[model samples]
Target: MTKLISKTIALLILTSFSMLKSQSVKEILKQNGSFRKDTIFSIKSDSKETYLPVTIIKGKEKGPVFTIVAGIHGYEYPPIIAVQELLKEIEPENIKGSLIIIPIANVESFLKRVPFVNPLDQKNLNTAFPGLSNGTPTDQIAHLITKEIIPNSTIFLDIHGGDASEDLLPFVCYYNRKDTPENTKRAHELSVKLGIQYVVSYPYTLTSTEPAKYAFKEATQQGITALSIEAGKLGTVQKDNVDLIKTAVYNMLENSGNYAVKKSKTVNQKSTVLLNQQDYIRVPENGIFYSELKSGDKVKKNQILGYISDEFGNKKYDIVSQTTGIILYKVGTPPVNKGETLFCIGYNE
Candidate 1:
């Protein structure tokens, strides 16, 4: 999309949302495509404040409202950078509908360099969905997302990478269940069409009755077609991972017939399908771990993936895989505390 066309679309969006002023989700989504960025602000004690940075763009043509959320775990860097690149790459003329881009959802976590949880209130942002307005900082941010972002999106993606302690394989995950079979099918199709060879089906778990702690779960349970992507690893900004996410996302939006994106060339890759993630192995006790496997490695049931030893090396116990599958993600760093996730295994059989 050229600059002139882009500006025209922006004008259209601005004109459409001319009466928009409030921070209500409905009002925010109704506005024009002039590439507006808004901050969802939350006040803290002592008059201090934190905010979630969000960019809302509406194309001239209306189609699926595609949303991309990153930086939920602040220490996860690749996805954070990837979303920025996507922001630069997208042109309004090419996009058919609206775009909701969250470059960094956990602002304090990113600023404070915290992993997994928000540094301000010690809450996991990912687990704070349908958040409380009167709750902690993380909760406030999550609440804004649940209320302002997730519900309005037709096709949603909550992007992430391995946090500081993780070594992860790149894969996309979508939900499936008996009760919401239609929702599950739509989500599964989006995941498969995302162009990532490696994919996983979310184990049938979350229900409408449960609290929507996770962003992806929150979206999925609402009958929206949503999926989560894990591409980067260990809080590092790797270029391949960033490009992987950008390309996958771009193709996803384009293939949906919602975007008129024209690419210079096509990326060639092997095709892969969905695998079911069956186990999330956690550390039994605080210890130094020795991993015998890396991400994407295949394993058999009861296979010894690694071991944990006490500081003095006096006591040790093997961390074994309970299923025959691929090591989707594992604790990449040596330090392992009790209850921390050690491995998430996925399988085809």
Candidate 2:
């Protein structure tokens, strides 16, 4: 009789736990606490009919809140896959902290498979940051992400892939310049926990000054940890890379004490080149250009990088490197325009 009573109590406890687990992410959003959902901004135009969906997954267990944002440029689908796959693996019972995921930060851009170039205002969604309250549609989207999504986050991972016209090698980024002692240490620790092979420290460049920059930098300034990760290309979805990133993100949450998964391999920030000094070589003039060097090739100062010729091939201008470095990325598009970046070169030193 006593044994039967104990078994009944155990079953009751398990049933209660299962009931709690069945609560949807939406139900979690409506709860009162440090966690609540508010639309900090919105974009509604006649031509574009969609809303930028942001979810705040704030765990009531009193731990860190990490935000994962993607699809800022629409076509970057691998990160979206990563976020969705991650959501499936996380159990509310195991999560001690919060995880806010904006799988498609730019919903219209994702639907169109194009970067949100503000149709009416002529602005890129990415370039419009710290977005004003009364700004354009793109600006409002940026404002929404910044105001609603970023404030409560203790850590942020803004995942992206190459924009249109290029494919990227699987890599992760933690801008070295934005790191404080706390953030730098947090980034390094998270890098190890994620277990992605190539751990790079991106320096503050003009490229780093936009899009995720304001949120990442602001998160750091607020003593929060932030890292940006990029993999694959604009429209194409690399399934393997997506799976790898999903695993890494899961491992990170596990390490952060939010999930009960096995720990991942710890990686060193310095093991890879961790290029902090980087620059892009832009096309000097409009021409039919041919690049002799591919991505990841090393070049010396003044080396023959490529050649540009007119339509008839009558005259050609040789493009050479001004510095010795590794080619991190090269534009995949042809018939290049003057002032458009052709190659991203990073110095090891």
Candidate lDDT (C-alpha), each: 0.80, 0.67
Query: Candidate 2, 219: how far from true, in Å?
Result: 3.2
Name model 1 segments beyond 4 Å from true: 1-22, 32-40, 43-48, 264-268
Q: Kindly list the per-residue Cα lDDT of model 1 for residues 1-349, writing each as its tens digit.
A: 6999986885575444433434765676677763445544443534445666677777777788888899999999999999988788777777787888888998778978999998777889888888887787777877778877888999889999999989999999987766878777877776776668888986667656888788988888777788899998988899999888887787777766666776653453678756975688989999999976899999998888889999998558898888888888999998999998899888875
lDDT of 2: 0.67
lDDT top scorer: 1
Q: What is the Cα-based lDDT of residue 240 in candidate 1?
A: 91
Which ranges in model 2 have alpha carbons more than 4 Å from their true place? 1-41, 45-49, 116-122, 204-215, 263-271
TM-scores, all candidates, are: 0.89, 0.78
Residue pairs with colliding backbones in model 1 are: 10-34, 13-32, 13-33, 14-32
lDDT of 1 at 330: 93
Candidate 2, 277: how far from true, in Å? 1.3
Evaluate model 1: give its TM-score. 0.89
